[model samples]
Target: MKKAEDAQRLLRTLSTEMPEGWKKDYAGVRNEYRQAMEDAARQAALEINQTDPEVIEQFKKLRDDLFSSLSNHQARWPVLLLSEQRSVEYRQSVQAFEAKHSEFVRFMRQST
Candidate 1:
């Protein structure tokens, strides 16, 4: 989704010297995601296809994992910005971790 790409850009930007008030903007965006997710869940509940117990169980499992990983994902961003130098090595390491975490998210999305 275009919004997902936009989120990645803003996130990377936040790691590289964010603008004033960006933290509040980031939190708001996060809340928006929660709201959207809730809306999707409501839609799922209404759909006739949502009757399967196994499917519902899988969705619950993924939701738990997603929230747990979100904590680590948020922590990693500030860790990437730890040094004032912002060396290539640090960037590369954080990028690699980000890639792996992104893949984890993709897996979670598919699971749900």
Candidate 2:
């Protein structure tokens, strides 16, 4: 949860500092993520092998948690930007988060 907050903070900072034109790019990327997640959920539904009620409940809880966090970040993206003082740091944070998220999505898709 702490890591998620840290990532959100960095994302807000970067979003504020970004040029106005980049908002369109951001929207595009966000849409891609949305599509990927939708596909992942569909795949998970089709591929989930466990028949036990307990394990299925656990999986649903975990999936809900992940989707909630990601949705929070996406929801906050419309807020205005900050200055460039910490731009480098925030950019690095965003990149790290993106890499981690992409890997998580890939793993989830494969595991499902």
Q: How many clashes show up per model?
A: 0, 2
Task: Provide the global lDDT of candidate 2 against the true structure.
Answer: 0.55
lDDT of 1 by residue, 1-112 (tens): 3354456566567656667766666666655544554454444445424567876666656545554555555565444344457677667655665564455445445544
Poorly placed runs, candidate 2 (over 4 Å): 1-20, 79-110
State, as a TM-score between 0 and 1, how close model 1 is to the true structure. Answer: 0.46
**Cα-based lDDT at residue 24, candidate 2:** 62
lDDT of 2 by residue, 1-112 (tens): 2333344444454466686665565565555655655566666666666775765665566566556656654454332342345456445645655655555555455556
Worst lDDT run of 10 residues, candidate 2, spans 77-86
Q: lDDT of each structure?
A: 0.54, 0.55
C-alpha positional error of residue 44 in candidate 2 after TM-score superposition, expressed in Å: 1.1
